[model samples]
Target: MEYVTLGKTGLKISRMGFGGIPIQRIDADGTKKLMKMLVEKGLNYIDTARGYTVSESFIGEGIEGMRDRFVLATKSMSRTKEAMAKDIDISLENLRTDYIDLYQVHNPNMEQLLTVIGEGGALEALKEAKEAGKIGHIGITVHSLEVFEKALEMDWVETIMFPYNIVERQGEELIHKCSEKNIGFIDMKPLAGGAIEDGRLALRFVCANPDVTVVIPGMYDVSEIEKNMEAVEDVSELTAEELEAMEKVRKQLGTNFCRRCNYCQPCTVGINISGCFLFQGYLDRYGLEDWAKDRYGAMAVKAGACVECGACETRCPYNLPIRQMLKKCAEEFGA
Candidate 1:
């Protein structure tokens, strides 16, 4: 695997990192197996988050003996100094490590961003943790273009994680700025939250960008790691067939599609918002009608359960017309 220094942090890591979100679906033993595989494959960067239930603890169990082999990074949703400080200690204990390589202020809106950097905010705790040798560096993860641009101006932001894939290139210009400013650009949602059906093409598209320091695609199985590694290691130019395929994906999945960040949670009627969109994508794009319908049918709360409440839309950083989209899903699923 090709390795590069993560901008500003001065820590060397593989260009292809392991995203820890999917670990929620697997057990600690399973995560351990994947970590072993990662070591064998020469991948040294692992990104997880405090909000990802059991992710930190699972990783702690997974990398028990070989913690030194990887650079650990994680984030939290806490915005206050007390919350962030408490979270840092919790992360350290859960990861079974004394220090974390990078701890990020997870996705925050413009208002929350100001609150985090304001007096007695999360930034204060982050700096304290850094001085206390609990965290090696600090960064920010963002979903909005406004927050992404704002993070660039902060001197404390050593790295930035944002979505950048074939279907979502809204951050291209700012991503270039990340490289110019010597900040590590971590590419998330390389497959557009499973919207793009072609994994190889999705990875190839993200890796082609020179400004991205590393691309972290969520993986839970060994086969996934292998497939992603192949795409990341292929340094050849994009073939005409690949370019054409990418265009097809762009046309099929426009920017209005959901990235499945799940920021739009707690549906007023308790509907699984992202699950609806995911199955809908399968039904519409992947030709998995039977499978999609079965999964959609299994959900206790269906898309039709939406109460037309705009609560989810307001919380959505992407400002997606979620109610309308859910209505379409209700019609599609006939529920």
Candidate 2:
């Protein structure tokens, strides 16, 4: 595996880091297996979050004895000083470590970001933790371009995590600024929340960018790690065929496809908004009809159950046409 220094933090990490989200789908034992593979392969950067159910715990168990082998990073949604401090302790306990390599304020909007930096805010806790040696550095994860641009200007931000893939290039300019300013830029959702079917192509597309410090595509299995590792290590420009494939991907998904941020929650009818769109994508784009139908069937509240109250759209950061999209899903699945 190839490695690079995470900007400003001076921690050398693999070009392809481990994203802890998918560990929720696998057991601790499975995570241990992945940890073993990662250690053997020399991928040292691990990212987890307090919000992801059981992810931190599974990773804790996975890296039990070999904790020093990886640079552990995690984030929380807490906005206040008290909550952020408390969450740091909880994350430390969950990760079974006394110190965390990086602690990030996860995905705060512009308003929430202010609350984080205000008096009695999460930034206070982050700074205190760094001074106390509880965390090595501070960073942030963001979904909005506004927050990304703002984070670039903050001296406290050591790293920034944002979505970058074949379909989402909105942060391309800010990503360059991250490099210019010496803030490590971590790429999330390299597959655009699994919307892009060709994982090899997706991984290649993200790794080709010189500015991306590390790209974390959530991997649950060993074969995926090997494939992604190869894609990142190749260090070659996009072949003409790959360029054409990317163009087709851009045309197919367009700009409006859900990135699966799940900001649009509490679907008045309890519909799993992103889940419906995911299954719909499988059914429509991937030709996995029976498989997609089975997953869609498992959803307790189908897209047809949408009340069209326009509540979800208001919360969507991307401002997706979720109501209309759900209507199409309803028609597609006969829900």
Candidate 3:
């Protein structure tokens, strides 16, 4: 229920924003019901991406009548001006809104970022969209620390979204700089993309950082919304017990566990990279050997299938050695 101005953008939004990724798992009607709950609970900030498969459209359906009550934000991966313009229109049509509150450049790398700011780049289209009243503010979502750092220097960036969780505090210093520069810092993967099992503790850890303008946890279920609300609404300071719990989470998860963002898709050989890692973690860490093996068997492409093209490693935001990890899984699973 606590509200804060999204720095530089001047938009007042709830600290806990609704992440639109999980909506892809549910139908429009389900999303509509969840949207009603979001409005009733006063979580007025929404985040979605064009790449999130039907998420934007479902949100549009869900927020049809309650558009005025929310500050809607969405992103696209288009790098060219023409592509960005087209994506903007598509986003509008899908969101069922004429004016988007914020439009972001989605996870561009060094070369792409340079290209985007260059002639006939996506930034040109984003600027045009703002001028045309199609969007209110311009922001960016980055997985690379380099991109995040570079984005801070760009005058066009009003907000920056990055993964910040109990296990991944690598951006802690840069995040503080965001507050100093008056740029809104939107926290993505506050739960480390499901690596951190304790949702309440994860949410609490994120909300404790005053620099984070908002934290968007993907929600498809109303029950999740209620539990997240409880975590975000608690205004008290982090107790010693809570801090200890966070440390325990870090030690347990380590840095190598997959966050399941699925950026490493189209695995060159059809390997289910994230799924393989997920099942492997369950088997290795949790000792759920039978269940994990059952699920691993269900995957059409197992870890042994990895040709070690190293494509997934480049795409991984966390710099995970996926090929090697898969090799371990192959040795363990005997696939």
TM-score of 2: 0.97
Q: Is candidate 1 or candidate 2 better by lDDT?
A: 1
> Candidate 2, which segments miss by more than 4 Å at Cα?
none
- The 0-to-1 C-alpha lDDT of every candidate, in the order given, reads 0.95, 0.94, 0.94
lDDT of 1 at 294: 98
In lDDT terms, how accurate is model 3?
0.94
How accurate locally is residue 223 in candidate 3, as Cα lDDT from 0 to 100? 94
Best by TM-score: 1
- List model 3 lDDT by residue over 1-335, tens digit each: 99999999999999999999999899999999999998899999999999999999999988997899999999999999999999999999999999999999999999999999999999999999999999999999998889999999999999999999999999999999999999999999999988777899999999999999999999889999999999999979999999999999888888898989898887999998989988988897778999999999999989999898899898887789999999999999999
Across residues 7-102, which tens digit of lDDT does each residue of candidate 1 receive? 999999999999999999999999999999999999999999999999999999899989999999999999999999999999999999999999
Total backbone collisions, model 2: 0
| TM-score, candidate number 3 | 0.98
In model 2, how large is the Cα lDDT of residue 12?
A: 95
- Best-fitting candidate, scored by lDDT: 1
lDDT, model 2: 0.94
Clashes of each: 0, 0, 0
- Estimated TM-score per prediction? 0.98, 0.97, 0.98
Candidate 3 clashes: the total is 0
